[model samples]
Target: MIQASISAVPGLIVSFLILAALVAAPTALVAKARSKPWPLRTALAVYLVGIAAVTLLPGDAGLESWQCDTGMPTRLFTSVSSLLNIALFAPGALLAVFLFRRPVTVAAAFGALSGALELAQSAGHLGRSCSVTDLAANATGALLGSSAGALWIYLRRQSPGKPLRDLAWGMSLGALAVLAVGGVFESRIDRVDIVARDDQKRALAETAVQADEWITAAARGVFGSDTQVRQTATATASVTEPDEGGCRLRITATTNHGTISGSWPAKTLESARSSDVRADEGSLGAREVAAAAARLAREWFPQHAAGSVQRVRPVGHGPTTVYRVTYRRYAHGVLMPMRLDLTLTGTGRVLGFAAETVADPVLPPVTVDEAEAKALAQGAAGAPGEFRRALLLARQVRGVWRPVWLVGDGSGGRASGRDVAVDAVTGERIAGEISGAATPTAATGGPPSSR
Candidate 1:
């Protein structure tokens, strides 16, 4: 239980703190307003907003234990989770309802707020999920809170003018109880460092996959896809050790996405650097190329997408040197995806960038309304097991899809094969044996199929 509390503590703490303020502020106003509809309505409104903020602000994806990625045969309990959500929120909502006479207004406010939270998640604007299950759960919580309030009102009406102090005590005690219960599920503090290089970014990602100890060190707990950093201090690597010149970089990321204090190290920085001061004029250098790409990319994304640009120097480049820039963009929903990659060059010049778009394969096109991209993606999964595992290991990448001309499949298999180019945003294929192979063309820089 302590372990569970520690893991989920972050979300829980934020949720409860916000909930407390919402509960106290509104209840006080509602109490002062007496039977008036406005005060209670306003409180409900604030509560809903609070819920949305708490749900979204945390970068960590709930608790590590909360997520079970067993691979293939995955079960997304939209229904069960939804039910649990209702159980979670219903009590508070019912309490609010019982405390007010305007049940209809409360219901409307609760539903609208729940819907808005879900929409934020759906749009992928918020880090949290926009789940139908959450909507249902929020609604249920609101209803239950309101109902409890209604019951209290009914009992109070029996005594007519009995001391108002009596009611105040009960409400106060109830609030305290809620707060106490919340204490059991708070998430601990976590710190994470966001690096400026793609290879570094992936190095951290790989650590999460390859070394459990590494992740435990970085996060202070079992890390998950959603481990969040409350505050980040940026430090430019003062010196890049030439010996650690592998494409992947090693960084320390600390998080508490687990039951106990788990300090873990995860590698993050990754990129290609110039082997030496080269004189290849026409061939743009990695840093210079990345900068130019970032500028172009910023111009390319949907204006509304939330993003940031980071400047990175290849280890040895000194104070006067201009390094590469990495561009990161995040959006909402199951389709709400985030893409991160390079943009600028070593000379601080513009360069091409890489991007990834994570969207539900079934969502129809906003432009041509073509076939569902998700279905097409799934069809490429090769098999059902592959389909199930794909979700767990989906890695979107950029780069022109290049065809490995006449590539041999080995094992006395000399059939021509097209190599799938995976850059930074979209690439997921289940392993399977195929009889023949097709030649792959250089990525034209569009969809996976185009590659």
Candidate 2:
């Protein structure tokens, strides 16, 4: 939640300038009409605008709508950020109540404001995420703030807050109603789930053995010959019916000194499974678990799997405490482009590992280099190209994986920009574009068959 708040600052800064310009207008009118102090009104206006800025502009506007990429919050505590969100907006709602002396009017205005903000976010206006949870959090804050302000005015032997006691009930009812409607929509959204079976042996014994050997050999290369290595335990793999994303093979296994696991589902490493893997309690904390996962990943595939741990957060999400670590993958020994995610339950128990591994990218040839490709894309679009990247990969196209030089341009396919696939052999361009941000859940799209 704190991480999310910090990210909102960039957009909030922009809105603040806008808010600053209009602050005087609101302050003059409110202070004069309500017989309030100038300093107090100015301060209140500033506070409300700041709240509006944060509430409206949360984070990057990925070229996708409803980027619930963080995955749904299963537990109640997952939404403590909602509480902070409420606090941020409360002051403004309270000020509105004081100025209007009407709880109903203030609450209605907040509802409309929240709705507009949500729409703007969805439409990719200010580079912020559109969240249903945020709307609820803002509404909850506004209702409470309005009620409190009205109550304060009433206690002062005034008629301002008299309607609030009854209005509070209406506010609660309205919130529940909105949640119910949103809940219906959310429930209708499809999800990818797995059914698991514990195996005394991995899916293919020889393949698993090869993967194990890959890890051990890489471990020796990475950690030296004297490093303590782990032996693989029989893994638990799930076979789920193919969804829109295609059939995903997920498995979790514990190793001798650590753990080894992987999933072939999402482009991001953290989103392999919806459930949590429990580890032995009172054991390894966050850093230890991350180290073990990193070591295992390095050993699993030294060249491609090399990465630096980016972010680590301890979440009380499942039965056992889990450490979710994001590792930025190194491509051609350079940082960025790819990412690996590792989640370890308590005591070094590996929960899951995910990555988009272009196992064998045959770089045919490059007729169009980076600069030329950028110019080509810009000329084709007749607009300024913001981003350009060239990488060789066996892009699965038409149920076949063919080598291509993926050239990304900021043409905003999803509005975040997408990569154009250039034929490595023919030097011709493909029709589609790969998105810049990691895809959250897979949906209907003509894709090469999933491997």
Candidate 3:
């Protein structure tokens, strides 16, 4: 709070000067017809300016534009200041209605002002979201103030002395009711900085295939011999080139089961052990594949872990079809973030598998469900980083799978988003993947995964 007040000074000065310039003429005119206009209008102006400064100022950086900013996703309405943001504007609207004796005009004008402020925050890259919900809350406060002021005016006419005090008491009672209703509001997990589109992988696949620059054999062997394999490679060589930390490539195979994607560098292939067709006594299905994968990916297994099938799909066409089995970690009904995927050819040959790892010993409780975790993820998207979405997953650490929330932003490729992992239960940020424009801290650093 102290830091907030101190930082708000610069914003307050600027907001006051700008607002005064825009409203000086109207304010001057109102002063002519009103009693105590100067003091009241001045107070209203101060209130308006103060609210603006408090809400929008003290950004992470100075005078940022869209091009240069990069911010993390921020959760909204989770702090005392957020509530204060709504309350601070109420007095100004009340003062305006008192001055102009026009509740509707004051309410409508203040509502428009609130909208404009939200718009500016979004467009101006001022380190805040142009949230529709915030606008509604601001407008609601203005309306509440207008009602109070108008009621006070009415009561004054009906009973001259102590009318304002009576109105204040009534409003206090109403405010209590509003607070009671507001108690239900909770902070939601929102996924921000998402993949721009699903088609993003398509372009990379096309390019790697066109250039014939990526590994096709590993995917072919893993996804099945006859499944049609498509691959794409990208790195951070130049603005138009894929050439970052070497080059990462993705192999997508369309099989009869649906689609299976494998990613790695050609030389640094993350090799996997596959099963022989004759080894499995049971028929092919989600359950059969999951059981088989559990054995193959036993290195990732924990004494406390159990496996459930997330999906089973047949992709590709013709002579060979690969059934992709996605086996996920589970704790009771809650899905853990850790996963192991298995693909099988028509002949029941194991195609390949990939699994996630967790180095952190901390496993969060399941306090936050998927819905709330998702909301938190979206709110994590920050400046220049529009929130895309979040997913709940478990990362394997010391052979134990822990629940995690994966947050992402818009970048590109498999590793392109500003990604962060959070402890699902504790709401504490866990260092895992840092993919967007920012560099990873030492604790969160790891080899960038392909998918």
- lDDT against the true structure, per candidate, is 0.38, 0.53, 0.51
**lDDT score, candidate 2, position 224:** 40
Q: What lDDT score goes with residue 341 in model 1?
A: 46
Q: Put down candidate 3 lDDT per residue, 1-451, tens digits, no spaces.
A: 2134446345556665777667755665677667445767766765666666655664653222322111221322454544555576678888887877766666666776776665565557565544444555677678888888889889887432354554565466445534532332222213233222223465555556643433455445444456443433344222212233434454443444234343443332333444333333334655555555555445333421344444556665544556676544444433444445556665466755555422223445667765665566556543455445455555543344566666665244232446766667787666544221112122122212312
Q: Which candidate should be chosen as best, given TM-score against the real structure?
A: 2
- Residues 175-290 of candidate 2 have per-residue lDDT tens digits of 76567545633664232111111121333554556555555543343334543454444343454223333234343333333343454332112223323354557477766776
Residue 426 CA displacement from its true place in model 2, Å: 54
TM-scores, all candidates, are: 0.26, 0.38, 0.31
Q: Which stretch of 10 consecutive residues in model 2 shows the poorest summed lDDT?
A: 191-200
Higher-scoring candidate on lDDT, 2 or 3: 2
Q: Write model 1 residue lDDT over 269-302, tens digit each, in one string.
A: 2221221233222434555555455554443333
Candidate 1 lDDT at 248 equals 35
- Misplaced by over 4 Å in model 3 are 1-36, 55-58, 61-79, 125-129, 157-451
